[model samples]
Target chain A: MTRRASMAASLVGFGVSVAAIFLLPSVLELFTLINATIYVSMAILALSLALIWGYGGILCFGQAAFFGLGGYTYAVAAINFGDSTWAVVLAMVVPALFAALLGYFMFWGRIGDVYLGVITLTMTLIFFKLFNATAGDAYKIGKAALGGFNGIPSTPPLNLPWDVGSPLAPEDIWYIAASLLVLLYFGSRWLLRTSFGRVVVSIRENERRSELLGYDVRRYKLGIFTIGGAMAGISGILFANCVFVSPTMFSLFYSAQVIIWVTVGGIGTLLGPIIGAIALQMIVAKLGTLEVIDPNVVLGSILLLFVLLVPKGLLPLMQSGFDRLRRPKAPVPVEPAIRPTATPAARRPEPVSAPVGSAPATNTLGGS
Target chain B: MDLAVVVLLQVIAAVASLVLISIGLAVIFGMMRVINLAHGEFIMLGAYAVIYATRWGVNLWVAMLVVAPIVVGLIGVVVERTVIRFLYGRMIDTMLATWGLSLLLIGAATMIFGNVTAGVSAPLGGVTIGEYQTSLYELVIVAIVTAVVLALMAVLRFTQAGLIARATMQNPAMAASLGIDTSKVYAVTFGAGAALSGLAGALISPLSGVVPTMGVAYVAKAFITVISGGAAIITGTLSASTLLGSLNTLATFVATPVIGEVTLLFAAIVLLRILPQGITGKFFRRAL
Candidate 1:
């Protein structure tokens, strides 16, 4: 398929999916819509990580820190302003600002990928511990008490843009969440097609080479990392509206789960992580209903299976299978032209080291 | 003077714990360049080994010293064969794989033991210092840590296997050309790292108890110490542990544990910013 043809097809598919989701409330109960809102919010979180880690070659283990910060900021601001509208804006700005600051230090300081993961993770833990420790009355912010480990409960639900007193119903909230997911998904897809996206992807492919070509590697990385944080902040706002914001949002478990969602969805593609998040969340919800078996065991085993057997993830696997089916019947002359262009769209980022199955020639103990 | 002695003891204990948890990571990550995110889970496994052994009527000392390391070391060997061997030199993939491994280990442990915290009490009685009383086990930890570091140093400096392992890590192709089985060296080194982690877990089990998710707490500290320590495995691990550990303990004494932890993390970030290659990466460049 040509680039234009493939793009049009994806756009049509995206539109159908969004429309289906917006109309889902008619088919499902109110309780299910509430649950769906949470799942949509999680999908948004997964998509944010996918953009940064999958496309940018930067792995952020502490994405949840930004997420929790957004939720808490929203909760506190909502309580103070007695309106959810401005609180939502504060939620996005707070996390984006934090990410900008953190990313500047991380990228400008020349922190390696391995150390980046460690640093972000430690930062998340610090946030978790800091919040968990703030249980006293002195921990109050304005009218809202920073309830420490209990988290800020009874957070004001997202209100309409025009009115402070009117809050959306659970069904309406589900539509909003679903619409946000669709918009963000297509927005990221469109961004990836832009020149900046190409530059970031090129940087991910080879940082030193990008630098030699006059690209500011650090600035680009900071930009993407901050954008990822903003997306995560948006997810947090959606989540806070659905379930009360808590310290657990900043926990390592959530951090690890976000990675799993991106990995299992197939990195590098915008759609994979969103699908991975929703699918895994559904499986988890179903598993929770079962009392006999421990869900962690099932989830952990699935993660292991994905990493070991399907390292490229479900999307890549499906893409490759589709490619294989289509390749034989196609003419040989068009194959080479289509192959190169099609790959970047569905391509898994090459492993940072040498290709798998080959012995790496570089000294392992030297600089990372 | 007594209060000073107590603080000194706490500092030593803190440093020892950091060193103990990180030595294994230093070997696996520093030497092999394979980021083992499951290093903490290996420690947790060791603690569980001790807990299970003691329940089966084994002595506490025996459970901690002998059984825990052996079980976890064996598990390490199995992990290397099945998962890690394929991922040699691919740091990020190894990280993801090991993280999955960590989650699996945590889940499996939870299934077997449930979510409740289980523990073995410290066997030694408390010791008084001036107006303060502290666990005698702290002293035991200090002694064990010293012995372990000394033993590691001796083995790495004086043994033929150590030479082969170092050669394999430095240049696997050259080592292979010289007829050394680099894969075997990697397996042994990984197993040894796991054993050390197990030993650390066993030693601390009495103090903090054993839990499936306990690995999360130790993994970050271990990574921070190893990374800050830099490439020279032993010297790097020791120096970084002492620096961070002492700072952490002093901070804890000054304020609260939460503040202490935050201080430690902030210190690590600052240190990384100043010395991105880590402390030993800059200072002890030639030290082993």
Candidate 2:
């Protein structure tokens, strides 16, 4: 199915973006607005997996490795530099570099699919173990100390640009986070709309076919993996700004939660992960307050119920339901039939990777 | 010289436990291609089963040998029918669902067992080698692990049931056409895997003690061993466990537990880079 949203979807997305960035703060309570920042940051984490798993077809189980690295990088850099700006940039760069390095081993070595999952999963656990062992004065990286289980609590908050004297208020931080999420939602949608995005998605659908068509599938996979890592890093920076950087960031629980958000939010759509992360985090957080039930039991049950009943997830289910009400004259197969019945022989000759203008498979692959 | 003997025992103990914990996960992944994220929890369930059974007047050996696998095997069957049956071939979904199952198991254990409890101790006493001393249980464990691997290989190689399982895994459609029930095979294989994990848990409880969250310590190591083992499940598990378990024990002996873990991960990265499909993927391709 084409991932591109229709004109109406674009319009609705714009409205949602405006509402989230410009309107939601006024309506939400002070407590919830602060919590919403965490949710927004987590939504980015969910989106990172969505890009990798949903579109790139790479189910990276160690996303939190990059994420925790982002937090720790920011905490360490921020402490050392006495400014959050460079730390924020370093947070994104460090994780991307790490992913690139790790991805180099896996992809260049032809480690794809399920094996990739195990390696990445093990990598995250390794980070958790390594970080947790970093106790005492011996583990400090410059001015910042790796506090082992008790993560760096003294992490500097993001200041107004380079003005380290003035830190952003929680309200201001919320503004930046909420707006950054909106900008990123559009950015992700834009990235998918680009030639690069379609090629990545096509590779996900059929790697061998894409390779036969002359695209270096390994490079595309690595590129997407790196981008996902950087996106996760940004989320880490935002997360550390609110909560202190800790080893728990690299824990399996966070790793699972990001995948859960993407699954629940619905894969193949940016908005789905955002919605899923916020809703589930709110549910689990609310449940955490109640002493009666362990939040994990409820979380696990909900995930189980969702996977069994709605494996396609909430977004696609809702879209189909909406499509049913809107289109009485046709079925779901009509959308895919937009592409020509066969590849035009005249257009099949040269420039195998150009993704030339207006050709169904090559150009605007997901054009709605 | 005694230190060398002690280190050798450590490496053997490490490799044996790695095999014990990972064999079931290897079976499930090898046969069905289903990554049971809750494989570690299945181990936990087995340990708990032993503890409960022993508390209910069953002999410790009976609890460990028979009750653990039976209890967990049945649970695995139930899991397959309810959750896993629908998720065949969907690897990522299976991982997430089983991960959720693990969370439920951990939470349930925490609620029921109150997070901590007294566990059964190893039966044997210490054995000394010159200046160094070690647990005699470690030797027994190594012996038992070897027997378990041998029995598993024998079953898969010699039995009619093993042949049917092999055929079904090779081509479920063909097996079904041949009038064999593939789904039943899948269920049985998954149960067997869980049973093995349960047995591993029971075996390990004496060394590590039983806790709700103990599975977290095992599942990653098991996954690494199984995945690094590659297409050949039995031999792969053996080879990967020996290589990895030795590196881990040797590093821990030289440095610390954390360094040992880092060494294992580093070794896995190098192994996968060198042999992406794993050890069995490159060699012993035909052997089950």
Candidate 3:
């Protein structure tokens, strides 16, 4: 608990993470390295979900809308912007701006959970249909060509002018991806530790409480939503470089997959989602290679099992098991509130007005 | 006059299909808090069931009647008891869980059905109405949709069981306090929703080709219809679908079909911006 000891532990953990990133390919079997890189990208995407759902308390069903936008933006920019670092930056910024504008309307309007999810889903569908529609020879945006349904092909790989070797290879790309992942992971963690991040979490737990505490909750929510969208855009930039960006990348199914990664890992935990993405993708990919039986059947069964048995996700399940093993003989306190009772109308619904940390739930745009 | 007749028939056909899909979706949403993204999968499965059953020498109508509801209903029960039961109160998780179920169903169907488009012959053949050639199957679809709508309205309006379902949906704890078994209500609602989905699938299997990925296409439209319809039963869904479908149909006629679809999306977005409660919700409020 000493500052020196804490710093040492932190340094050690950082070293271990970096080592795992570099050495995971050699230690694991069957494209684990490539898989890890992709999962890292997915984790970036999942982080956006965490920021929105876990912290902001907004369940956006269409994070893939931003992801797809990021991907298309990156692909289009990389193709047009002459293989420079500026192209990648532009790709990230364009989508970030787009997300900020969308989030402004949604958050400012005071959309509730179900309505928020619907709006986001609809936005993604609109993007999908639009992308599909504009995919023609005549359609052109800057130097980038919109290929419609058949997406832009032959997108240039990452171009690091100062790198000593060929940056186009998977290994080089992996290094770049690994570096960016570290930066983003730490950057996000640091962001959450800041006042803004605290406000975001407060917003998630109770908007009304936060509002009453005199914080501008709407502005904070919009701010975080936009940041998450930007982070997703960053992931999209990486994704476009890793694989060919297509309109299908923006599909609801793809958005659903991002949620699955976050859920399977554990929402609210920083590392849980990345781990979930890596593990689930490996399982799906392996199952897909199996003969006779369908991978989708396996996926469905697993999803059902997870949702039923391990609702908080694999991380929480593992954590609980670890805790139990660490302290086995302690008496478990029974929660009287959760006890099952037949025809149970005894308990009253607790009026949770808002999370207690900061601000009240005030939709400022209502006045507008 | 000929062009007008063609447009009318097209509108009728589109309305029949739209009504079938929208009503089922509306009912499911009304009963269960679950916005079943996989509802389309049930429809797809029913279509496949009819396709396979017809191939096995069963009469098309009999196969459609027997296979659709049962197949989708059984899947619904399994889904409700297993995955969806846990996902209550968590909208994002519900969406994700249903989506996973959808992917599995679509993928499994692809593996089994080989991703080929297949169709079933309608029970009634083509009919000539005056100078126009109209399919009797289309007329049957329209009639069936109408009958189903009327039956649904009656059940929701008059039946004690329907009242319980509505009560449970509006307030689960209150309904339970009033002696309704909320768990049973939830299960029944889920089953009924699945059955409607299957029914829609069976009805439209002949009109649209049956394929694994077909459900994905319908998923957005169904959700859009429900949202546009204002989360109510019968009237909202029917009116929204008709309005949107007509817009879509007319847009296609006036411009390139792609532009029409885009225009519809644009209109919906604009409408969503203007009236978040949706068209049906606004109208119902004013009418009352």
Candidate 4:
């Protein structure tokens, strides 16, 4: 029975993926290919957010910083090295390294959650401001010059090792993206199922408890953060190849939008964010058919509604509802028996007081 | 001599406006623990208010007096109740939610008022201070922000409500135990922060043309100011503002506007690295 259920689930997941790949292009023409490519890039970004938030429980408000870093790094490299695959590798590697260095300093120095959010956010702002200023400068990393505000333009496309002759066409690019997405999805799933993955989840659930269990919490966080950064770097490489790289990629607005994407999709679930990216983009494409509504307004309204109403994300909500419908009806609906009885108030769990700086906020307040 | 003085006035005016908004943000953050990402949207609303009022033929200063704070404060309260209430304690969620909210507001504003930078006329063309003929309107912004800051300091020091706010910020449970309504203080403080941002927007609209995207610039600077001033979580947001304003004026007078901005951000980050607690901790230690 369990084997049947697992097989059914995998088949359903595969059906959904295949439908998305084939139908996405039919509804929107070749634009879907471009859209999928962008979503793939966004998925890489979502992975970064998921790793930081879902596993480490560090709410980074500026994953775009790393995304932008990877993008600019790739763009600069591409411009300099012409379209060398090796250059593309370096482009992605540089950002991952940079994120690792950033994580190292931040994690080791013991910047608590709030301050860590701020530090990363500040880096985002600083990068944009710096890059925005550098736009006019004749600064060249390799052969490519930093265009500053105008951004690097007309950069050569990626040169894959096995093109099988001609450059990777639009349809081919879509296939590449779909395949990469599949690999990442499965890889992330496998990673989370590992012992280290279990440790990461436990850290998210209770950092202090994990530390008391003698796990080096910061090292684990840094490792996962670097992985997230690498995923973002890979996404950036794909993004640079898809379209012209620009400074706007590094902007806070993009960073903020990426966070919204992860939230809209559901953070912890591996496949959820990809669903979110594709769903939101498709909705915007459909809205594009209606000439009246501005795309920004449509996107903004939907995102606002989703973030406010469906914070657990659309995918998770749908999955649970689907599971409910599929399941056999119980003779009596479980209520009190489902939840364990509340522990005695007198023997209440001690308030896990964080170091004044690291204290998990009980009250919701917006900052970074 | 004239160019130098005009540039100086421009610098002072810009810095002063930034300070007022940042200080307002700092105080709100100090009291309520909200970063208020939509603070810039409040500024945008204020600018629109002044613009609409000006079209209605109201005296600029009088219109600002009647409109900015009230409009901004009302929006603040509505937001506090509708959105911000859900965000308390979940800082990351709040940040992302407010960011989404800001995008919604900006998109709505863009749809209503096309994508264009609209200019508002300064009430007084120029007011002469000694040998310097400065824009009297710009100086007025500086004066208003200064007066407001002073009033806030006095309130925080003496008023019972202010004391309660300070107490709640320092120790929420203790304040609650003493029957102080900390939640009310948080809501009110958030509203007040929104109002300051609006006021700053209205005042600066004359010097800096109002645009939907203008909020982006202010958000970054305000964050920098908050960090630099180290104002009791959020109180000193103004101090960084004032300092940055002065530094901005000095930089622009000596070099280019871009250099001034770059320098300010660079200095702020450096300051952040050196003094984690910011200027507040530097000036006065909060007793543990």
Candidate 5:
């Protein structure tokens, strides 16, 4: 699709998502409504990872570090200030700052991509250990006790932006969550279209080459990493409002699960991961109810099958099937949009795309 | 003096265990560049193999030494043929796939063995160290690890299999041109790595018992040790395991177990920050 066409389609997606926030609650039960809210929040988390891992080339295994930080930050800030507004802002800013600090060490140190995985993985372990160890009265962060293993059961929910007394019901939270998801989806699309996003992708594809080409690779990496961290923090805020914040938020399970969501969804595509997160979460939830099948078994099988057979993920697989049905021509893989109209369409670095906003998320991703 | 002897013995045991758990992972990673996130699962499988073997009236020694490695090694070969071969060059994808495999193995173990169980108990009585007494099994572990290390060295240094494996890892295309079946080498090497992991798991089973999720604990430590080891597989792994394991053990003695674990991770972070290629990546450039 042309850039104009893609932008128009995005506007439509943006519209439908906004419509769903208010429309879905009317049709769904309260429990389902709450679950949908959780899904949206998780989708936001997935999108944050998609941006960094897919485009920025930084495979952060410790995304949950920011996520848990966001939750803890909001919990502590909310309790101390007796207000949700500043807590929300603090949630985003604190994790972003944390990511910036960590990213500075990583990017400046010339850490290899795999070592980035180890460092980030260690970060999550540290967060988990720190948070889990907070079990006593002495472990108080402001008035809100870290509560250690129990987490902060007293975590205040999000009140109205203008009205402090009106804490959002599950239904109301769903509206905000769904609307935010739509906005982020578009925001990610817009970001990928910009020259800044191109540099990030270029860096992902060939960091040394991009660096030699005069773009400061580390700065681009640090930018996307911080942005991704902030987005993850927002998800944490939403998650806190929905459920009590806990140490499990920074767990290895979550750290690895988020990556599985992206990989199973489609690594390079934003929409793929969002759908993957929501869909996989729903599937796992459903599996939880069944007695015979283990959720991990199902999840593991799906991930294995996806990796072995559909390595690019389910979204790309379906999109290609749709393309084949729509046209007899062989699927022309997504092209780099950096050159816009000047380039005839150089083959994308990876061979995967969704017809909608197929921003240069080339799937043949490897540094060497 | 008696107390000091025990403390030193404890540290050696700790370092030896670290080397055992991480060496297989180092071999696979240092040779093939595959992350093998399922390595922990491989270890768990070995422990389970011991559990089932002993339960089925096999000797405890045979279960830990022979059955675990062979069973898990065969499984490793199958995994390579079916899953890993497709993901040879893609490091991130390989991690994801192996992670999935890890989950699969965990779930499978749960179905077969239930959530947790006491595996085969450690053999032998306590041995006195001056006024202090410690589990003789600790000494046994140290001895077996030493044997494993020497055997690994002999294999890598003296065998044609070792040379071909190294050649294939160094330059697969050139190795292929030289009529070396690099694909078979990859499969065998992966099996060997998995077999080593299995042996480590079996060795530790009597101490820690068996659980499906047990691999989760080992995987991170293995990764930390191997990455800290850097490029040279054997020397790198030995040095890293010694440095990290001693720090971990000494820290445990000084503070809480949680602090000890955290210190290991923290030290790895600092180490990687200073030497991104890992310890061997910077020093010991020539010692394989």
Candidate 6:
């Protein structure tokens, strides 16, 4: 399939998913409206990381930093503005701005990929520590007290755009979450179809080659990183509406869990992370209720099994199975060659035979 | 004068701990070019080995000095055989895989030894330095670190096994062509690195205690030290540890531990910005 056709197919698939979500309350009576809303929010968070890591080839170990920042910004802004609409705007803007500044220093400085991981992890720890230490009554922004580790309680939920007095019902919130997910999903697909997305993917393939081709690699990287931060911020806003924002939002565990979701879902696809997040989270929630086995053991085992046995993840596995059924003889291998107009899967078959010592196209390791 | 002496001791102790934690990572990451995100877990395993050994009627010294390294080294060998052997050249994949390994180790440890922090009291007591008293164990750590560095230097510089290990790291294909059994060398080198980490963990257990998640705290600092140290393993690790470690200790003395940590991270950022490849990458080009 051509890139345009594949994208169109994805858009249709996304529409179907959105429709299913809208019709879920009646079809699936077991899931509470509030619980479904929370699941949608988690899926959005997973999609944020999937965009940056899977497509941009930038593995951010501290996505939760931007995520928590968004939540805190929304909560604090809501207390001051006495409205959720403005709070949501601040939530996205603040994290995007922060990401832009951080990405400027990091990308322009030309920090290697390994160090990038370390630096981002440090940033998350810093945020976690900073928030955890704000237990005193003095750490107040406007009227909302930063309750340290205990976290801010009873912050206002999303209200109607014009009437601040009337908050959205759980059902309304679910609809909003589902709608936002569909919009963002299609929006990202559209963005990836643009020329700028091609450049970003090219840079991810080979930074030096892209630079030689006159692309400003750092600028493109910074843009994608900021967009990812904004996406994470949006997820945070949905999260704050679902559950109260806490310091745990910035924890390393959440950051690791996001990585797991993206990896399990398959990194390079739009829909993979959403499926991974919702599916794994439901499994985790189920495991939590079963008191016999420790959830960490199960999670750790799953992660190990996936990394070793099925590194390409569930979506790719399913795709490959489907492709085999369609055409049994010619199994296409995914290669990281520069194929600007080809669909992602179609680009996979060509061996990435770049010059020796040149950057591996699929590798994000950075630096020799 | 006494306060000055105590502060100097603290600085030396800080440097010693940094070196001990990072030397293993330098070997595995710097020499092998395999990013072992599970390096911290190896240290954690070492700490647990010492604790378990002592509980099972071994002497504290024996448990720390002998059992911990041996136990963790064997575990490292098993890990290398099963997981790391397949991921030699793929740096990022190795990182992801090892990170998964780390989580597994942490979970397993938690299962075996609940979620509680365990520890042994610092031995040899405190010694008076004019006005203030400091742990004698701190001085012991400094001495031990000095010995470990010297021993590592001697082995790498003078021994045949060291030459083969170095050869394998520099060019595995060439080393294998020379009938050196490059795979064995890689496995041995990784085990040695893990043993060093285990030793460091056992040595520090009295101060920090043993916890399944304790590796998280040490891993970041070790990565910073090793990365800032650069390509040359010994000189890089030593110089980087001294610079970052002293700065951290001095900052702690001046303010709080939190400020000290923040200062260390800021210092690393500034240092990396100035010298992107690291301290040794620029200066100690010939010193290995």
Best model number under DockQ: 5
True contacts kept of each: 0.47, 0.55, 0.37, 0.22, 0.56, 0.27
Give a tens-digit lDDT track for model 4, residues A1-368. 13355447767877887787766665766775787788777776776676667555666656877777777877776566555566667766877788788888777776655556666777777677667777544666666777878777775666566342445666667767777776777677667667777787767666778899999988888878888877887777778768867777778777776766767776555556666776776776777797576666766666667656765666656654554565557332221110110111111132443232221221001000
- Per-residue lDDT for B185-266 in model 5, tens only? 9999999999999999999999996899999989988998999899899999999988988888889889987888888899
- Candidate 5 positional error at B77, Å: 1.1
Q: For model 1, what is the error of residue B238's alpha carbon versus the real structure, in angstroms, after optimal superposition?
A: 1.2
lDDT of 3: 0.72
Q: In every candidate, how many clashes are there?
A: 0, 0, 13, 20, 2, 3
lDDT of each: 0.83, 0.84, 0.72, 0.69, 0.85, 0.81
lDDT per residue (tens digit) for residues A136-199 in model 2: 9999999889999999999889997788999988888898987888777778778887879988
**Candidate 5 overall Cα lDDT vs. reference?**
0.85
What would the per-residue lDDT of candidate 1 be over residues B1-288, giving only the tens digit for each residue? 999999999999999989999998998987788878899999999999999999999999999999999999999999999998877756776777888889888878888888889999888999998799998988998999899999988888789987888788779999999999888898999999999999989998998978999998999889988888888999999988888898889999999988998888888878888888888879978788
The candidate 3 chain A region of ten consecutive residues with least summed lDDT is A335-344
Chain A TM-score (model 1)? 0.89
- Regions of model 6 farther than 4 Å from truth: A2-8, A26-33, A329-350, A353-368
Chain A TM-score for each candidate, in the given order? 0.89, 0.88, 0.84, 0.82, 0.89, 0.89
Whose lDDT is greatest here? 5
The alpha-carbon lDDT assigned to residue A113 of candidate 6 equals 70
Model 5 chain B worst lDDT window (10 residues): B113-122
Error of 1 at A342 (Å): 18
Question: What value does DockQ give for candidate 3?
Answer: 0.43
Worst 10 residues of 1 chain A by lDDT: A359-368
Write the candidate numbers in order of decreasing DockQ.
Answer: 5, 2, 1, 3, 6, 4
Candidate 3: tens digits of C-alpha lDDT, residues A235-333: 887777777777888887778787777666766655667677767887878777775677777776676566556655766556556545755785432
Q: Candidate 1, what DockQ?
A: 0.48
lDDT by residue for model 3 (B115-172), tens: 7889876667787656778788888888888887888778877899878877887899
